[model samples]
Target: MRLIQIINDIRLKRKLSLIFITVAVLPLLISGIYLTNKLREVMVSNAFEQASDNVERVQKRTAEVINVALDISYQLSNDNRMKSIASRSYDSYNEVIQTYRQYTDIRDYVRLYKEIKAIRLYASNPTMLNNWEFMQPDEQTTKEAWYVSALNKKGLAGWGYIQDERDQKHYLSLVRKINLDDLKNESVLVINVNSDLLNSILSQESFATMIVDDSNNIVAANRPDLYGKNLSAVHAESNMLWQSEGSFDAVMNGKNSKVVIANLNPQNSWNGLRIISIFTISDIVHDANAVIRISAFVVGGCLVIAVLLVYASASLITGRLLRLSKHMSQVGTLSWDSYLDLDGKDEIGQLSRQFNALVHRISQLMFEVEESNQQKQLLLQKQNDIKFKMLASQVNPHFLFNTLESIRMEAHLRGEEDLAQAVWQLSILIRNSLEVGSRQIPLSEELNMVRCYLELHKFRFEDRLQYKMEIDPATEGIEIPPLIIQPLVENSILHGLDRKEDPTLITVRTRLNDHGELFVEIQDDGAGIPPKKMKDLTMRLMDSEEPGNRIGLRNVNDRLQLTYGQGARLSIESEEGRGTCITFCIPKKGVEPVVFSDNR
Candidate 1:
């Protein structure tokens, strides 16, 4: 009940603002937030789908490569020539030559299959040449993991990745034990598959992909650095191989990533092979985040615009009521004929008409007095105009310029070159100050004035002041507002340099950017303005109504905006105890001179 009473006491405009926000802007904000969240979720889902597809593709290609290796191993195992050579015991040279010819046929098979790296046959027969294609089982060979595993498997083909003894190159080895009953001898045939073939299958995948064996050792990966490393070393979860198909979030190399694991063929000899795809989640959501940011900005902008429109509409509707209320307060002093010209059938309009009717009856008594007061107001306005013109004329630049010229002449006659130079600079300043006919002058003219002012200050400060002017020749012809650069330079000298004990250095620079825009900068190496003070100064520059000082920084800023648009406005950057820099840009195409009423 208390809240209701307070709301009733509030004005109609405030109630309207509340209604507009609740009915329009509130729903918009809610929907915008919902849509943004939904869009992010959709993007994440799409990324997961892409990762899943890549994993599936890698699984298919890896299965094909493994199947090729399996086919090569089966062919080598079933070859009659391989079995015959293992069963026979060569004695004559011609018999050994025939065995060599049969082994050459096996070599032809390795050459036919590009995936086959090399083929090795180890036998108990001492007559066989222990060369590239044949080897005698030594202690090192028997101790190897592949050799032991193959021997345990007996005649069944065993598959594992191992390094070649000759080149130290990795290869997928298919080892099978052969038992020859004719010679009562046993032999081993090893088929080495090129690891590059497996790498080529994974290379086409876009995401970071890897193939790991049953032992979790990485056989092939897109990044060479990860090859031969354990899968558990990259991702903490070593059980990822057990999962047939799934994705989970994990940290890889200290970065947030999504890992997708898919089993290759479960029935094949390479059943333990798993294709893992890992990608940064941030990379997937980057575009979505950009879209959300833009959407948020648009939503916020709409809300602000809605508030402004509501306020304006409410103010328009309530203005008549306020005017009627004011007239009621001054009813005793109002004339009878001074009626409100409001035309509406609304309650406020009816009240205004009624007030006009009541005032008409009281106006006859004060009509003569109102006429006399009107005449007095007209006379006061005329007096104000005369005073304004007189004040404008009193700002005489000619007197100051002539006095400086006289001083310059006297200094020259007395042979005081430095004094005469300072006097000449002061005269230039006075002459430029008097030229109020045009708002814009050549950038060269403005820079020349700044140079003259700084030179005069250099004379006054002596060794305590150092100045540098670096002006691009291309920017000299552009036109800008007069005194725009000078006041900033003056500000640096007065506020920036005054507090420092060491020598102060001021730099004035102008350059043409790639866009053909002229940028002017003024920097000082002195005690800089504080951050809080710099913020206050920036706010003051933005305020147009309050031109506090006659020749102040705000005055220059307002003039720059008036002559050129907001594009050409002053920007202040300062750090305490470091320095200050004031910069502004001017387009190559000059703007027309805008005549301001407050120029005088």
Candidate 2:
């Protein structure tokens, strides 16, 4: 289970490699095993059949040799020289010589037939020559198995093993008893068969061959060591000899073997001879084994090549998927200026093309969002400017200035010069305040308006109000929003000085800093606001949110910020019962010129 999980956790390329190997190699392995088994069976069967055929051929050859030997024995039994010798008709040496000459004819038969080793005549006649061609049976010769067996079955041919007197070599002899009643004597004819004939017949076979007699003794064999041995000792089972034809599997000579048994003419002799063939199983299946090895190599090589091809192809495909995954991971963090360049109609290529389109659409939507936001900011700034202008226009100074002019004229006509001057200052102050058409005006003109207003305030308060203006000459020509400074001064008089018991002093100062920023300050020596109230008003000025009750101060800050962005700002410093100083800084180059409509 752990191995399976590990395989599952493997990458797609490795997984595909495994799948390819299983698909390609599994059938090959099964087929190779099946073919090997079938080939082994077929090869072994063919070896058995071939061995059986070879044994049959050897059986036929041995039968032919036995038949030829039997025919020679029958011919010898009827020979006229042997009949004369059996009749004892030869008395003189001349007659014996003639008979001996005829006996030489039988000896010539042995030389003529290669299967016949020698032919010997064993007679009871006294006149027979005891030479190589003829033998007079002695006590030992007559006691021999072949001699005794032949004499018991008179005139009938029989077969047995014997050792030749001339070479002491073993041979299979065909023995027949010759009975001649006219001569009142008996003779035995022995035809010694050459063992090389049977050996040659068995030796021609490819496998080991043995000719076994009825006694289970091996009469002839391809392996000389097996000759004359009991056949049962070689193969534990002698039942194979009884099987006249066919094959079987058995263990022989410490090896697995196929045994084929055949008989050499069972009907011709009572003592049957069997031809047994033994072939080792390994030798029979040798070719099949070679074929199986070659097939295995070929199949293994094909599997390796197939796996390599699968790995390469799968890697190529999965590599594109991995690259696509990487690109998608970077979608929001980086610019989507480019896309995958895989150019094919495959699924991954299609996915890449679609991803590029998606990124392009996203970029376009983001651009639209940014453009919309910029337009909303501009619209908001315009609305705030319009609101500021409307707030400033709320106090109409034209009518008030005209009324002050009439008051000044009346004071002058009544001969009140001091009151008339005060009324004239009031008229000038009102005129300056009425000039609301210009969003910006020169600082000198605004300062003059401030002076007029202060003079009028001083005239009204008498000894209770005192004020001073310390303005820099360099800042006099600087453009500022109209009515900005006067509001701060008005706020100080209304909120701080109005409740003061002692005489109040208000100071208005303007200067340009080294960094080209204009600083304006309104200071009052009067009752200051509480710490909490001061903090609240400071927050109102600094906050960009809409003003609540402190509209005048917030309006001034808003107008500065709208025109000059964050570069222009208002800051207030105050201490309870000490004084209050409201200061604002405007960058010289930061302010934007404001355009005002004459309709206001």
Candidate 3:
């Protein structure tokens, strides 16, 4: 009877202890889930609100700066000074440059840097800035298209860029055209807008903000070195392009961001230029019901009471399990280099000692993984080395032209004047075809190459092939793919000019567009190709079609795609005998002075 009573009482106590532990665990689990969810929701919402608010502030400030640029153009268009320059003619370039020297302060009106981090270049005659032959901008002048556009358009023309002929400083050009009637000349008044003010605006808003003119070339940026790099989202981390042009939220820089795009032109002109503004995520929401974390005596008073009540049965299991979990979390990612540190005397200590031995086994396996990675990297390095060689050996037609140029020079020295001029022009054409190895080159360089080829054809046909270049000088040195213009010219010649009857005319035109691309048109009075054939030829431009032909046109197009990616391409337009006009656009990439890294 005594034994039966003892056993029954012990069983009842055990049952009671289990019930108490279950009740305690239920509350802890419920509280943990609720707290974790509440905290996450509150913090995430706060992050979103902060990003939105900060970008909104940046958007507003950027607008004011943009308006100032627009207003400067507006004010100058209606200025008495511009009217005076238009009405008078100066005898010397100094007189013309001095004519509107007073307007240099226009830079300040544009919110440019106070210390003047930028400068300007100007020409006295309209043709001096226009006529390709007389314009010699080697490294000191920037030819601005807005100068001429302002003359023709009669207002603030450039928020984009003209050629930076003067290599001394980088600037945003503010140009106005004055007819200067007295001298029978057009004087372009150029104001060099310092980049720092724009940079300051970007600095206020983001870690990095870039301003690209329609040609996609970096015009202004918080990081100036990035200027001249392409900003195509499809190709890089450039923010998603604004299709309809408005503000929106996005994921950027490991956090939320607000991107606002305002069309630079009023009346909601989608086709006109626009400005993109960005702001961070932290500035938007305020913290009110933020979830807070509580630590113990993690278990503290309540856990202690529960433990005391159940210690005789559950203490050993709970302690050992908690210790295992703690070591697991700490060992996994927190201390991969030192997960085997074990020194203790209890049950938890014995488990750690076993874990330390297991870790040593894992370490040997990791050593093999590291060895494999080293081998893989070595192979990758070898592959890249080979690609570098291929880049070098890939023949640029310009190499042949340079050889031809040397022959022409020899001919000139020997009094073969006609042959020398002919080869010189041919060399120029070839150079244009091969110039795209660098990140940037003048728009003029591209056109010059075209003109050289045109001149070459003119000689081949004994002047039957007539060609003219109508390039906006301001477009010179604005940067483009090295081979972008040449291929279009080649296509026009092969499919159009080469088979023309009577005297043929080919014209190459270059202009800056709002989408940040150079609209280059190559037109010819020759038979055109069928649409189907044109498309097929285009697709095969980069792929092999002819076994060993250079497929000069195709090769050049492929290169443009590779060099400039999305914003560069080749297309053809033609008719039976009416004429063929080929238009291809190149986005301006900034100057990368050295083409071959020669790192090897």
Reference-based TM-score of each model: 0.41, 0.42, 0.35
Mind giving the per-residue lDDT tens digits that candidate 2 earns over 1-600? 665345434665566667766657675777678677777777787787788778778877887887777887777767765676656745676876676775566767777888878888788767666676677788999898778877777567766666678888767777777776553467778887778888988877768888876556677899988886776676676557467667777777687777778766533343556788888866676536656776777677767766776676666677778888888887857667867665445567778899999999999999999999999999999999999999888856666777788998999999998899998987777666556665678787788888887888888898889999998877776788788888789878876778798999999998877887888999998898888887788777667674455447888888888877776777788887888899989986753333435893
lDDT of 1 by residue, 1-600 (tens): 665445444556566777687657686877688776777676777778888988888888777766666776677667777777766677875787767775775688678877778888777666665666767788888788767766566567666667777798766676777665543476777878777887888888667888877667788888888787887776676446466568887777788678899876533342356788888756576537656776777777677867776666566566767877767776645434455766555555566777787677556646777898999999999999999999988846667777788988999999999999988988877777777455467777888889998998889888778999999877776777677788889999986778888999999999988877778899998899988888888887777654546478888777767766788878888898999999988765653233434653
Which candidate number has the best lDDT?
A: 2
Please write out the lDDT profile of model 3 over residues 51-156, one tens digit for every residue: 3554455456555655554455455545555455445446777765565555554445434534233333333544222222123233233333454455565433
* Residue 548 alpha-carbon offset, candidate 3, angstroms: 70
Go through the candidates in order and give the C-alpha RMSD of each one to the true structure: 20.5, 45.4, 27.0
- A best-first ranking of the candidates according to their TM-score comes to 2, 1, 3
Order of the predicted models by lDDT, top scorer first? 2, 1, 3
Error at 140, model 3, angstroms: 12
Q: In model 2, where is the ten-residue run with the lowest total lDDT? A: 263-272
- For residue 114, what is the lDDT in candidate 1? 76
User: Candidate 2's error at 430, in angstroms?
Assistant: 99
lDDT of 1: 0.75
The lDDT of each candidate is 0.75, 0.76, 0.58
Candidate 3 RMSD to the correct structure: 27.0
The Cα error of candidate 2 at residue 484, in Å, is: 99
